[model samples]
Target: MKQDHRVVRRTAAALAAGALAAGALAGCSSKNQVPSIGYGVDAVIASYNGGSTLGANSGAAAVFSRVLTGFFYTGPDGQPVADTDSGTAKEVPGDAQTIQYRLSPEGVYSDGVQTSCDDLVLVWAAHSGRFTKAGPGGPVPLFDAASTDGYRDIERVDCQPGSKDATVVFRPGKHYSAWKTLFNAAELMPAHVIAAQVKIPNVVTPVQTGDQPTLERIADFWNNGWKLAPGKVDLTLLPSSGPYRIDSFGDKDGLVLVKNEKWWGDQPRTPRIVVWDGHSDLKSKVSDKSVGVLDVGAGSLGDVNLGGFRRQNLPGRGVEQLVLGTGGVFGSADARRAFALCVPRQALFDKFGHPDYNVKLGLGAGPLNSRTVQQDSVYYQAISGAGDKYKGGDATASQAAASSGMQNQTVRVGYLEPDEQHTAMVAAIGDACRAAGITVIDAGAPDFTASQLTDGKVDAILGGTAGMPGPSGSLNATDAIASLRTGAGLNFGRFGNGRYDAIADQLAAEDNSGTVLNLLTEQENLLWSEMPSIPLFAAPRTIGFGDGMENGVAGPTKEGAGWNMDRWVLKR
Candidate 1:
């Protein structure tokens, strides 16, 4: 679940203009005269390849969930379910480390090409962390993959030239518990399209032969090829394998999806779906019958008129936290602790975590204590009350600690601009830290990117720790390991502790439930003491369905409201 830190922000006026342009196109069609369903999104889609580092976001995940078909998809319960319509995955008998995948005979891409083993091999190669280039310090991955958790354990993939069947073998004693999640539709791209882009005769041969020059070329294209803009997208490079295909896209207008003519599975009930930017004027759009469904942040729920709509609040898969940098004014453990002590977690929670919202959402109303376990889970244990000291806004003890060597020190706090919750959170931090003789500066920007942390542009970032959902509706331990382990890909805070990393590793690998719970407790205690990041609250999302729609429930996973868009029916 590792993703880039850039949050998409577009003004309402800009987005409305873009939506009007897309609306004009939808009005041109009369045969399928049903009105297009308008779905709202929060971010701009820069890349459609969710497996690549650049495309790993909620915006891309929601759009691609309908445009791509694979062996498995995240179900309503937040677990991976086998998609028999696309393919079949089963473990080989007598060998727990081997799994075989066979694509459906009728599965084909939008361009009339059959979905085959070549696509699987290309996805595996890009995500396996196998292709690397020599750096001055060490080897660096050529392809910027979002996460290599399960893929790195793969030994080899066996497939013929153009077969639809592929066999995957894992390394000896390397049994990944989340093996069912590998090569999902969100991660699979068209390999033939990529091969043609790089002028390679075929994708299977280069991966099988370990052709360095050819692999490097493929990696270069994989990393930077699929990036999109409002009017600059090349449709040929973005073919669809699922029931829907991207008819048009805009940064502010969002994505317009139409039924794929080549799709062989169940046809989509709605002929067209327009994913509009949720930042626009949703109230008016819904009233004018232009927008039929709204998926927005819970904080913005007040802005929308809920009349004639069925509204439900969903507990988001991401956790909001203040990510502290490891190499700045607050680099030392003591300084980080002092800052945490001054944060008013309870007050912040009381303001944002209204009991009414929690009651409707079926969520616990409090700040989350553990980064690994959600508050509503049976395995949740409040191991550390260390954060209890920060309930009040008083910072007398924090001030005493800062007086020694860090008095009057200026700390810059960064966040994604145009965000109401994050902006208020940053302001609250400034107010609380002011009494501690610490000057907190607001450094939020509209174009803030993840590189700011590593490049020292900001000392801390108030962002969400978006993790992949596990089988039990909790955050996956593999994602926790990826975010905290030493030199791990998702370790944005650069917090490293050998003991904590070991506990996370055991938690991810352990099959026994009791052992995993104990390991999670150990990990929580360490995070509380280390103060690498302060867990604020589990972010909440709200979805509203107009009277004209049916089966528009929100998903608990990262795909948000459109996880099951193909099943939605629009009433005439």
Candidate 2:
């Protein structure tokens, strides 16, 4: 695979991104001399679902297209400027019931509006009757807004007393840190520019918290508020704070973005261009000679071979355990344990997964075969320490104690969804389980929502998970326990224990991963002893790219061109 930082992987599915480098060596092409002749994709970007953050998970959406820029920037070491650790919403836990955040003095909007505490209020207050008349999306029990926040913890946004001070706070919602989780989806928006002519006062913050907003009226008000003003917005634009911005643009599908001269940390290459042509078929449009340079993007990985292009293979995050339905079908913890023990993870890893993906993992973590998700998460460690649980059904381990101390009459295996790679591994698991005297039926694929497991018919299915990725990238035990919070997506296995929960909560709310390791190690053993979901071979992230594409790296690898859009230039 053409692994390189230029194609850094992103959240959602696959991110489409990048500007073409100028070059005309053997394979990878060079950029166009005429600005009018810049290159871009045609069909790869059929929709605009990703937005600037590339927050959504489509492999094809994120690309070199510049996200609107902010005036100031957050460097690698830039301070987060937290108000306090205590309170309902802070990253750090404290005695207070709320935590607030202020924009850095360095913050600036592309339109040049000073980013202040009010802007923070504008973005975080969507749930506090600020965004719309609809609702806040997080901390369901506390504010009836948690569920609406689209899986994040967010309570309110507020402007502080001055230009230098902006604050975002998590409310004392029923759920612990639930408000903070909701804000995970938030990005800094141009507050002054967006607010200048806002037609609706509610829009100072968003009303609907769903990834898909419900208030069309408010959306229109925000997007076209300037039409009411009938003038161009003088908002400053820059690439300094953001990864990319519009320097110039092609009439139809091409754009030129310049690295922010005011960037605080990294010095990105200058004048990145993105162009698209809908004139031909999807494949033809991307490979057309008229396109000039070949830009690296998520969508570009499907068919090309990076090895053939002499590009390096970037590393991806490790895979997580594929848990099956807990309450729905894989009812007994022992039954789950038995199934896991029967999985041939080692075999799969040697053959298809990471050659040596034997990394620590936990309840909320996935396999640590790659760098895709944070391998150092507490969740991953818990799963890893529990590795022994898979010894079930095997002669070496004692028979798993049935939740009811009886062998499961019917064991139905489930899958997370369409990762496909997981399905193949599950088949391997089923084969091993069958040998252990367990009857496992392939339940086909799962819906992304995981609702399929709730239906009585599905006993178990293939599954995948994610965890926080701090630098070390190993799973932390406390993270595993905290991950069991009601409706926490990755804990579909429904793992539990009073001590584990306490550990999980403390670890999740705090930055102490080291202290939780031993606890997680024991937790791993207990879970493995019981076998909830067999830890299969960690999923391997693979990449490929076609010829004629150069100066760009592939996704599924470190240092890929996917995120480093500015690094891309033509090779002539």
In terms of lDDT, the best-performing candidate is 1
Candidate 2: deviation at residue 483, Å? 5.2
Q: What are the per-residue Cα lDDT tens digits for candidate 1 across 326-426?
A: 78776787777777777777777777644245542224457767665666566664453545565546756466446534467777777545456567777
TM-score of 2: 0.55
Q: What is the lDDT of residue 34 in candidate 2?
A: 33
Q: Which ten residues in a row have the lowest lDDT in candidate 1?
A: 3-12
In model 1, the Cα lDDT at residue 66 comes to 73
List, residue by residue over 436-524, the lDDT tens digit for candidate 2. Answer: 55656666542232334545556653432222110001121212232343433234444455654454444444445566565556555
Estimate TM-scores for all models: 0.86, 0.55
Runs in model 2 with CA error above 4 Å? 1-119, 122-158, 161-164, 167-186, 189-199, 202-308, 311-315, 355-385, 389-420, 437-464, 467-483, 489-499, 508-514, 522-534, 543-561
What local lDDT does model 2 show for residue 108?
50
**Model 1, residue pairs in steric clash:** none
